[model samples]
Target chain A: MIGRLNHVAIAVPDLEAASAQYRDALGATVGGPQDEPDHGVTVVFIELPNTKIELLYPLGEASPIQGFLDKNPSGGIHHVCYEVEDILVARDHLIETGARVLGGGEPKIGAHGKPVLFLHPKDFNGCLIELEQV
Target chain B: MIGRLNHVAIAVPDLEAASAQYRDALGATVGGPQDEPDHGVTVVFIELPNTKIELLYPLGEASPIQGFLDKNPSGGIHHVCYEVEDILVARDHLIETGARVLGGGEPKIGAHGKPVLFLHPKDFNGCLIELEQV
Candidate 1:
């Protein structure tokens, strides 16, 4: 099952402006940006008291966020990540329950360097749920 | 500043079906449904170790979720809630930082029986954020 809410990801058309908003406006501690080639997103982490916010920008034209932005135009909440003790265990259980795991059902290295799997939105009531091994 | 992530709200087409998916499929501990008339939504809470998942369904046609469902049809993530120590202090700070507080800048009694206010998505990188006084 899901553990702590690891981070909530927001896809932004402009990452710098988004980061500035969190830093200057919200007075949040904004972390440096890192490119997640596997996920095709350049991400900035906003450190909060109990959780983190991920600002995602399309790394390339083929980035998944690019498509989301194309449809949404203004960018928006892209996904929510939940931590799990063991992602493989969670994946197996979710698969048995008929949840479609995105990306061939294999765990990929997420922003935190943890193995992560994404559950299909349709299976999770329209929200893309990310399960990351803690 | 936020204290902790209280819950992530997901707007669902059917509350029962969504609850079943978490309870039966995900093996999560699901709570009873509650009608939040003021919010115009019926909600079910999914308890987790570090946070909760709130499943929201339109209580009436006038429900704000009704508009989201009409566009998404299948349902999806609605908003992310973060707990704050003092809501009024946080609200003033956010306002000074140029964040638009939704609903005329007044905190309403939310589902948890706590004061909650929503910030506009445009001000927060297109992610609708809810701050609750814990």
Candidate 2:
């Protein structure tokens, strides 16, 4: 079963501005920025009492956020991360039901330091979903 | 303060089909369909262990889902709802800090029978946010 919502990610053109808005304007506790070179993006987490909001920005020319921001100039929600009891079990179940796991069908170390897998958006009716093992 | 992640709303072209996908395929407990005329959408709640997923379909000629579905024909995540400890406090803080509340800044009765308010998509970096009093 899906445990809980881990975080919701938004692709932003300017990470500092987005982080500042959530911190200064919303009065939310904001974490410092961190670069995930493997993912080709830099991110800052806004700490909400319920769940975290991840602000993603391109870290390099090959960053995927570059493409997402190119299409949505004003930035937008990119994806959501939900916690799962066991990622391998969830992965097998999703595959058994014809859900395609992205990134070569293996889990990766996500921003939360948990094993995470991405499911194909087409399989989930056009919404990209991330499952993280808790 | 936000209490917990309440639910995530997804716009769907076919409510029954989407509900079935989550139920039979994802092994989730699905609830019966509900007509929310005030919101102009019919929704089905998929019960996950920690949170719920709301599948929404247009209910009338002027339903907002019609436009969202028109843009994303295959359907997609529409908005996310988070529980707030106090609705009025959260609203006042958000407004005072420059967040635009939707529907004239009044809390409406949402699907979960709670007082809910929607924040503007532009304010929080293009994510339509719902704050529910819990």
Candidate 3:
């Protein structure tokens, strides 16, 4: 079961501008960009009191977020992550309830170095959901 | 300045089905639908430990989310609401930094009965941002 709202990932066409917007324009504590080669994206963390907003930009040609940026030229909210206590149990329960997990239904070590699985957007009201074990 | 991420609003085409998905499949604490005629949406609150996910559905004829649902029939992330200490001060600062506030630049009572303002998506990495005085 989902516990806490982990972070909301926004795929931005320009990572620097998005980071600046959150840091300067929005007055939030933002971290430096870190390239996540495994995830195929560059991420900047905007730390909030209760949660985080991750600014994501495509890292390489085969980046998964590249397609999302292509569809949303300016950028958009890519996915919402929820923290789960036990990922395997969560995945099994979700699977039993007819929810499709992406990446061959296996939990991969996520950008945060935690076991994470992505759920199909269609099964989640068109909102891409990432379940991270915490 | 942005403080806490108050909630993430997801506009869904089918309110009941979406609520069920969160309640049954995701196993989150879900609240019943409440229609906000002024906001032109019916919202169901999914209470997370740190924040909330607001499931929005078109309420009346002039529902703002109708256009969003039209574009994304399955539903999608509509906006992200950030809590502000002072709505007016936040508005003035954002304006000084060249961010355009929607709805004629005036803070209106949001669905939560707090003063709120929406920022233009074009200036916000294509993500609609709502600032609420909390």
Best by TM-score: 3
Docking class of 1: medium
Report iRMS values in order.
1.8, 2.2, 0.6
State candidate 2's DockQ. Answer: 0.55
Residue B43 Cα positional deviation in candidate 2, in Å, after optimal superposition: 1.4
User: What's the ranking of the predictions by DockQ, best on top?
Assistant: 3, 1, 2
DockQ of 1: 0.65
User: How accurate locally is residue B95 in candidate 1, as Cα lDDT from 0 to 100?
Assistant: 93
After the best TM-score superposition of candidate 1, give how far the Cα of residue B72 lies from its true spot, in angstroms: 1.2
Q: What is the DockQ of each candidate?
A: 0.65, 0.55, 0.92
Top-DockQ structure, candidate number: 3
Q: Which rank order by lDDT, best down to worst?
A: 3, 1, 2
Per residue, candidate 1 scores C-alpha lDDT tens digits across A33-67 of: 89988778899998877788889999866898888
**Residue pairs in steric clash, candidate 3?**
none
lDDT of 1 by residue, B77-111 (tens): 88988888899999999898878999999999987
Per-residue CA lDDT of model 3 for B1-134, tens digit only, reads 79999999999989999999899999999999999999899999999999999999999999999999999999999999999999999999999999999989999999999999999999998999999998
Q: Specify the poorest-scoring 10-residue window by lDDT in model 1 chain B.
A: B1-10
Clashing pairs in 1: none
Candidate 3 Cα deviation (angstroms), residue B32: 0.8
lDDT against the true structure, each candidate: 0.86, 0.84, 0.94
